[model samples]
Target: MKKIFVYGSLMSGLDTDGNMNGAKLVHADCRTLHKYAMYIYEDYPFIFEGRSNYQIKGELYEVPADVLKHLDAYEGDFYFRKLAEIECGEETVSAFVYFGRGHFFGMKEVKGGDYRAFRGKDGN
Candidate 1:
């Protein structure tokens, strides 16, 4: 199994979360050790390195090899998968994170790291 950090739709309790079927939850409400930029691409959220602003808030999961392979295909070629450190509770651990690549265009950056809150799912 591989540890994967998800900050967008694959997060638990969100649309496309079913893509994580068969994966075990490692942690919830976790943040990245390093900061990154997050923006809304269409209706979905995507993040990239540089211009660090916020430590992304998301979840961690232990996914099987098959599932990880599936995720790679699911994420397509635009999102690059890489290992990164994240704050899971009080411990920092390394996990596979997908960094999205695309044109910024008219994308709006999210102030807070939480995508749910940005989407108004948390009623914030």
Candidate 2:
């Protein structure tokens, strides 16, 4: 199993029936990774290229290898998942990050907040 950091709709009980709705949460006290900007495109969430000192809130989940395939499919061509060092609790853990292919470049930055928190599912 591999640990994944989720900061958007994949969070527990918010959408897709919470973390266990599609994936399993392995750590309870996971640390949030900061210094990055989150953006929303259509209904999907993506991180933008930027610099920040604040941490974005999220959780660490243990995903089965098979489940990763499904997640990859859901992300589609708009995003490419890359291995990244994310803060989990007190230690740093390697997790998959979804990189957007410059789809939302025209939109303004969300400042110091989660992108999903601002935009709706329709990307409005």
Candidate 3:
């Protein structure tokens, strides 16, 4: 099993969660160890490496090799996966996070770095 951080669709209760059908949820209250830029495009969200005001909120999951392989292809070339530090409870661990490549011109910035809240989920 490998650790992965999912902030957008792949997170539970989201549209793309189906892609991670075989993954196990590890932590739900996970946050990026550092601040990063987050944006949304047609309801899809992507995170990018950069300094930002808020740490990206996400979830941690443990997935098998086959699931990881499927996620790589599901993310496509527009997004690249990289190891990033994540805060899970009082512990900090490295997990694979999908980041956007190149310019995301028209994408709207996600304030508070939460895709779920931004989309009006959870009554936020």
RMSD of each predicted structure: 1.9, 4.5, 1.7
The global Cα lDDT (0 to 1) of model 3 is 0.90
Segments of candidate 2 deviating more than 4 angstroms: 17-22, 28-34, 50-54, 105-108, 115-124
lDDT of 3 at 62: 97
TM-score of 1: 0.94
Residues 44-114 of candidate 1 have per-residue lDDT tens digits of 78888876989999999999999999999999987899999999889999999999887568888888878
User: What is the C-alpha lDDT profile of model 3 across 40-102, one tens digit per residue?
Assistant: 888778888865768999899999999999999999998999999999999999999999986
For every model in order, what is the number of clashing pairs? 0, 3, 0
lDDT value, residue 63 of candidate 1: 98
Model 2 lDDT per residue over 47-102, tens place: 64455634565667888887777777766887777776777657888887666677
Question: Which model, 1 or 2, shows the larger lDDT?
Answer: 1
CA deviation > 4 Å runs, candidate 3: none
